[model samples]
Target: MTIQSSYPYYLANRAVDANRDLEVIDKHTGEVATRVALADDAVVDRAIAAAVEATPAMARLPAHRRRDVLNGCADRFVERFDELAEILLVEGGKVIKDARGEVQRLIDTFRIAAEEATRIGGEVLPMDIAERSEGVLGFWKRVPIGPVSFITPFNFPYNLVAHKIAPAIAAGCPFILKPAEKTPIGALVLGEILAEFDLPEGAFSILPVPREDAARFTEDERLKLMSFTGSDKVGWMLKGKAGKKPVVMELGGNAACLVDADADLDDAVERLVFGGFYQAGQSCISVQRVLVHDAIYDALTERLVEQVGALRGGDPRDPETFVGPLISEDDAKRVVQWIEEAEAAGARRLVGGERDGAVVRPALLDRVPDDCKLFSEEVFGPAMILERFDDFDAALDRINRSRYGLQAGLFIRDIGKIRRAWDRLEVGGVIINDVPSFRVDHMPYGGVKDSGLGREGIKFAIEDMTEIRLLAIREA
Candidate 1:
């Protein structure tokens, strides 16, 4: 079942194969769908050096040419959109529809990067403050920070990686990418498409290296910046070892959604269900916690139970399958363990809590204890904890109790309460009437506290990969 290309990876615009390979497992059946060649430490060094060697050409490439390359990449992605979606289903375990959405996002990300390529500029500043400086002028525009190193997570193998790759291209920065071992196919295919472009040789590399063997990508001082999108534990550890180079971290979060007394009950339940279970709840901003005001708690709970109970769970290839298997059976069991422990601690399991193979049916629990693993940590599973609160202040305090503060959702129609949420929430972005999972490609998206550092949208990423360089001239 070699559904993807056979090339091990793309390095310096050439396909390279390695002696060792890692099994790419299909989460549904726990079967090896394909094998991806693993990069050795020497391969890692060569990839980085290739990117470094290409830096000068990439940096000097005109913005128009960069824009054309990015647009060309987007065109190539559209041509193989269905193929990439199927690869995402096989290697990433995403349902068909969700997989297609990821593919579309990949296209959109690159298109946005193409649009931004020509817009990279800085404002002119007046330098004639004194008589001696009357004929002087000063201005600054953004320039490529040089080569970039990116390590993307597996959950969103296509779109998340695009957030890193497309921006680097727009800014004319050579980048070395290390995709997650479990889901490296989409990235490798992306690298293949890029290789067909007129990009300078050694512009980029996409290799799958085990986390333990990835120090060359992280600790190397030659790379100007490193953009990491993954769990907090690993992301932070890599940041510490990344030397003095600027680092961007897109770490995990345990996001929450609040339903107030005056909110639209019907709308709130529908959106929350989607948010809590979408992508099997693997998103960093998934709705892990739901705080409902006591006034509408019972009604919302009934609706939520009905909604979550009806979601279909099964194979990733199934179009109707609303929930698919976790990345592995161990991950599914972890979700199950958390739900069972919460139930033992006196939490009421209002709905599903059974697991078959790697698929854990959507589990909805109310009155879960504050100390439960599901409550304190990022579950990354199809489970959501609901709690009832009387006062809004107390609810805000509860929301802020956790270390992670990526994003939070509030459904408040009242002006005062809406203003309060906007003013007081500690998260990066607040959703007015929707769940925290709501993210558009253009908006600046990131978090505070333990969730991570820096924003990841296309334009924002261009900002991270480029810095201002000022040039001043004086008439003699």
Candidate 2:
């Protein structure tokens, strides 16, 4: 399950043994795990040119062939499941169990894309609505939008990369992907699998380039669309530089979960614990705020503290470990400082704020100030804030106070309250009786406001990667 000493970058479906200047660290041990070749500006320009050149071949690729390519990728991923999970655990710092789950999601995403490849259908349009349109027939179908560019983050590397690559393959769009520098192994391995297929030359390239050199990915006029998943600051900056091409972004969020008086306390406690701390709470939709009704606030807080304290933190390779290290020591230090700042500002630290190197124990705080970073910004670590709410409407309003509107969760027995939250919540999706971290591979997933633009499920991404054209006929 160990990775090779060095891996090469892929350009135009061929492996280029360029100099391995970029070193990838094993997050758990803080040791250099492997090195990957880095793509420079010249290489990037060549990749974009290749993608532009291969645009027609990819567009003319039959639907059945596209489905076969995706299906083959799924099969290969299943065959090498353990290897992929191990890479995720070492390079991405995910616990072994969560790493395996992400691998399964990667497979599911490709399978879903395979199914959707053949389903990219067109519709007949009746164009005789007016007298001028008499004897006119029309139809419309989606076509590949040509070369696209993708920039993915380190968290959930496999599945997030799948969300971009799988749909591009399904919609017959050639693309270039620049994976996060912290974690490029998973995407490079995927390039190996993709090269096995007889895809059109220059159909895809997996590059691990420095952030400074990746500006071309956003500014290149040949690239038809740009897809980015990372911090809101960087996503918006790239959008401004993306020129005339369309941009799809899945930026981070500080999601909230509300617990009503009548909700199941046991179920709420269990889900909240997992939602707030899973994978060190690095996900964009990880539950960062828990709004509990006053009647059950004390009880839920007690139970949650016990569970959060009991979570194991150590080597991610251990099967018993639940809490793992953050991506780096600096990130762990940042989380610790934020917690200390909140405590100094009159917030109460309930449990688990200890830190050792990159591993920060899961933390829970009460009465966190609205202006504190922990409460207002995307923590992107294993920390959550607890708040008490008496009125349901006030609680909903509190959740809306933040600039982020990704997703929110509600645990309630009353159907009326569920409907109210559904209507009142400003997020993109509301989960009833569950945590906001819940997501299926096929579900349309994205956020509003500062959380970024556009949906990212396979079908939704396909729509973004393709353009519709109308075929019309007029009878003389």
Candidate 3:
């Protein structure tokens, strides 16, 4: 299950041992775990050109063939489940349990894509609605959107990459992917799996390169669409440069979870603890804010703090570890600084604000000012802020005040309030009786506003990766 000391990047479905210039660090130990081939601007250009050349062949690929390819990948992922989870732990600093969960998600995403591949159908239109089209028949079907590009982030590297790659394959769109440099092994390993398939020569390329050198991934006119998953800042910047191409962004969010007076305190506390600190809170939709009703705020906070404080923090290799390291020391320092700033600004740290290297103990705080970065911005770390709300509508309004509107969670016993939250909340989705962090692989998952654009489930992503072509027939 150990990773290779060096791995090659894929260029046009071929392994290229160009250079092991990029050293991927084991996030838990802060040591170099593996080195991966890095693609330069020329390699990127070549990959794009290859994708452009292979577009026609990819589009001509049969749906059955595409399904087979995806199903094959899913089966392979199952065989190497432990290996993939191990890589996630070493490269991404994800806890063993979370790593395995992501691996399972990876399998599920590809399987979903397999099911959708053959079902990419269109509907027949009734052209007889108009008198002029009385004898005419019309229909439209979706086709691949030509060459596409992807840039995935470090968090959830495997499944997020699966989100893009699986759909593109199912849609028969040739694509080029730039996985996060810090955790490229997972993507590179996926590239290895994909190379075994009989896809078009240049249908896909996985390049592990520096962000600066990846300008072509966004700027190149050859790519018909760009799908990016990362910080909002970088996602938007890439969109501006993407020129004329469609862009699908899954940027991070400072998601909020509301606990109502009638909610089950025990259930809410357990889910909230998992939502706020799972994978060290590196997920985009990780619960960053908890708004509890005044009636039970004190009780919920007590239970939440106790659970968060008890979470085990250590090497991700240990099955007992719940909270692992951040991506890097700098990231850990950044989270610590934000926590300190909030504490200095009158926020009370309930428990867990210590750091050792890249690992920061999960922290819980309350009475945080609305203006503090810890409260206002996306804290992609193991820290969450607790606040009291006296009114349900006021709590809904408070969640809407943020620029990000990815997803919100509500723990309520009343159906009316749940429906009201669904109707009133500006977020893309509202999780009833569950944390916002809950996401199934097939559900429409994306955000609004600063949280970014478009959705990323298999069918939704397939929609973005395709275009509609109309067919009209007239009987004489």
Candidate 4:
């Protein structure tokens, strides 16, 4: 059955067939609820026009006023949390309980961004470089960069969308949000909520367009920035298309989590199970590879095997379910293929190499060869390959060997060893004594190397979104 909201989900340009134009697919039941108008070049042009027209008014709104607008939306979102959670469950294949948490994360992201709005300020710089202008007073003002275009991904649609949308509004920049086509409803509802706050007609726009048309939205010269979160390949391509436009791209992560000899194996195991298998390992920061010290490798693997073996896999709506289906049946088949390739190339699936419908039990592998695709590529599914290392340096070496270095986790008690790992690990964020999956709403979250550029979260992203204009004055 196609689920329809009693209210219209699309905002701004009143196009009736938005639902059909976008082909919004239901990940759980694999059905199309409504065709969301896939923003074509023309729709993108209109959205851009709307945003550009709204930019001046948005910027004129005092930061405190902007906070009020954002907080209003956040309040509505929290009040109707259940409705948003259901949309996440049906559209993203997230289990009911996890789906609810996803909605809460979005709410938290908005609340944080709202608070950050009033805190946007610039610094003063002394004109010491110019001897003639030494007596001049110099200061700087932080202002919005006009219109911003947010292209969010399917995973964590609500929260990630909030990451982009909330900050854009808080920074006094009008936005045109293009949510992932598959999970557009929740984002659309968010835009609708912001609209309820009597925001200027063009303050923000959300269009559920397909991937092919996303570039068209960025093609407009008025789009001052493009904030995106998705796969590395696509993020890079978008960065290139964005030209000189500021781009905040949060890309893929084939993250490594190291378990050292001087660590807590039980805590590491528990966090890994939650991080790796939760969301069916579709998370970018999920523990894709674990580099365990040889001293505790066998013991760690045994506990991991037991924990993974006991996981429940099935209907996402069940609160007790440990694992849910992949985003789609095709994705499930692809994940199976990835595991099969790893096995054929000399990797051993220690447990759970089974699939029923879109649901696949989490699979753990050991002795995965360096030449295997599972080791070399981003296995963005519910499977993590295990590698054994004998020394601290060796573990660090193995962890840094992968091209994607978004975030890394190390379980260690030795301060010296932890410091050494921190020095050597080439990642944007590192978690000591915790798994890589741990991320708070306000932290500077992004990756190094092929993981893309810039950062997310309200504060850092706001810094990237605006340009500073220094002002100097001297008495005549």
Candidate 5:
């Protein structure tokens, strides 16, 4: 069955105007499968207006009722998991298995957010008085930051959008979600499913606005918070222009996978292949650097070469296809350019340096010079760069050299080495046994340095989305 929809962008309680048709390209075949509506300034205004109007109802809903509504949305989402997966596969270039995985992650996030809503609590405090008596009483509670703007990126469209929308719903905040233009259908479809429930009209609006106009909306003082998941460059731009509003950005990361001397080579190869090439390596937390302890460096490289060679790039709908086309031909071209630049600067491309249209075969590079572009930057493609270090301290130093501090993984059994790396890695989270991509829904997931500010987990985001208010009373 072909999933067809007319409205491209939904705003403020209605699917207003279908002015522009956003051509959605099937990443696998480079064919246009469907068109989504892109919103204009007028449409954006309507969304903003609706969010403003819905704030009162959002604030008025009791905590328990809000939890019920969020849970209902999650239930509705799980019921249509297959449909959601199909939409994601066609529109976002995610492999069928990964599309299903994203759906499951979204479900987990929603459930976690629902649980968080019920646990939103306040604390009672005792006050010491100098003016009169010691009978003064006080307590503190969290209040929702009204009119939150959620700007989600293209990678993992379904789950990332859910990460933003679910928490906003749980917090009882009116949300204006601006999903990435290239992959808007998945978000719009989810919006339709959400609209089916008795959500107070205008409580949530999904806008597919152009990237240029996105900055304009952030300038609006009516927006209390801006949550973004995208590039580090744009994340900083948001912080600058967000005015007085609070911003929570999940920015870029050149995630590292470290294999110490005591590590298992076979297991490291398995994890690296999955983490480096999944979703075409477009993930913010994708492992971009592979640091080996020089002892098993050559052996690990050979195994990685064998594994990355077998990765299949083709139709995303095919369950057997391990790799799929990138979001666009242009993005693929850019990846190609970056690899070529690295090679020109004296880096040796070991395997998989081919690109056809939007698909690039997974590539591995070694002998990366200090001046090579790939050594210091994120390729954000199915490419991995190898760096060998003899001393443990040197590997830790090299891993922390980059400006991005998102996530890092180390495969080792030495307690002292693990503890030292944990202290020296300078990232948001350190995984001792798993890949950097292993993220649970409730754990605080974020970065440090230029990677991003603030953390994103169900409960953590809720705390960031709200402000504390203390109530005090004394004998009048």
Candidate 6:
């Protein structure tokens, strides 16, 4: 059954239904699956004001209650897991298998946030240095950073939204969420589930607005911080406009995977197939680049081409579909143009570069020059580039040529080699014997340089949402 309905945005605890509705289209069919409330400038301001008004209440709420609220939301999410997955399929055009996994991630994140709520603590300080300071008693505790604003992207809407909302709830901070207008149903339904919990009034809001119309979200002083997950250009612009308020961004990346000659070829091939093309390659940390040793380059490239070719790219509603259409036809066109440009720049197509509507068949290119956009910029589409390297130092250096340093994959059994990569790679996280796209949701996930600004694991985000308050008492 096709899931179709109208969803409302939250202005604090009050459900706001606007007359102007944004149509949520199915990327594959280009059909309207549902509609969501579109927030005008006035509504966006009200949401921010509501968040500011609720900050004190969130601070005063008991830790236990906060834990319960998060747990309740997780429980509700688990109960409606399939429903949410269906929405993700229609709204984000995610393949069903990936959608299911995203749904489970949502549940895991909320549950993790629930556990983190009880762990919010501060360390005791002992002051006994000098005679004058010997009697001073000093300590610090974590306090909520008031209201937070999150602007999430179209990819992985459920889990990314959870990354922001769960931490705010865990840290007892009021939040305003601005989900991608094209894929807002997952977040809107999440708001509905959160509404079932015993949360304070004016604690949260989920507004869907045009990208050009969301400047207030960044410029408003009422919001203490803005957590953005999207393209590099947009995210940096948001940071520029978000003056005074702290801003955390999870921007774009051409995350790469390296295969050493001593590595397991079969294992590398399997992981690369999934990592390089999952979700149509729209992830910030997707395996966009594969750097293989010269000795095993031919063998690994042959296997990868065969494996990637075997993938079925079709309707996301089908459970067997491994790849689906992009977010829109324009995105698919953009990807095709990039691939063509790379080819003209001397890159050779190894397998799959066909396009049909919004579906660009999984593209694998070889000999892609470092100057090509496919190699230097974030593809954020279904395309993978393979290059061979002789020296380990040169290969690693090439990885750093791009501005992005989000994550990298290294396939090696040598402990020394692994340690070298951990020390040398400029990325935030490195996966050994696997792919760069591998993430467990609990690990510190962010990038260096242009990749992102801060960490985003459950506990880490909770720390970002709260600030330390020091209390010093001197002997009378």
Better of 2 and 4 by TM-score: 2
Residue 374, candidate 1: alpha-carbon lDDT:
86
Ten-residue region with minimum lDDT total, candidate 6:
12-21
TM-score of each: 0.97, 0.99, 0.99, 0.96, 0.96, 0.98
Among residues 3 or more apart in sequence or in different chains, the pairs in candidate 5 whose N, CA or C atoms overlap within 3 Å are 8-37
Winning candidate number (lDDT): 2
Candidate 2: which pairs clash?
none
**Which ranges of candidate 6 are over 4 A from the true structure?**
none
* Candidate 6: tens digits of C-alpha lDDT, residues 110-171: 99999999999997788787777888998999999999999998999899999999999999
lDDT of 2 by residue, 196-220 (tens): 9999999999999998899999999
- Evaluated against the true structure, the overall lDDT of model 5 is 0.84
Candidate 3 is scored at a TM of 0.99
Q: Please report how far candidate 2 places residue 473 from its true position, in Å.
A: 0.6
Give Cα distance to truth, residue 329, candidate 2, Å. 0.3
Candidate 5's C-alpha runs over 4 A off are: 129-133
Write model 4 residue lDDT over 388-471, tens digit each, in one string.
888788778878898888999988888888788878889998899888998999999998888878988899888877778888
RMSD of each: 1.5, 0.7, 0.8, 1.9, 1.7, 1.1
RMSD of 4: 1.9
Better of 1 and 3 by TM-score: 3
Colliding pairs, model 6: none
What's the TM for model 1?
Answer: 0.97
**Model 1 CA deviation exceeding 4 Å by range:** 129-135
lDDT per residue, candidate 3, 1-476, as tens digits?
Answer: 48898999999999999998999999988888988999999999999999999999999999999999999999999999999999999999998999999999999999999999999999998898879889998999999999999999999889999999999999999999999989999999999999999998999999998877999999999999999999999889889989999999988889999999999999999999999999999999999999999999989888988898899998898889999999999999999999999999999999997999999999999999988999999999999999999988989999999999999999998998988999999888899999999999999999999999999999999999999999999998
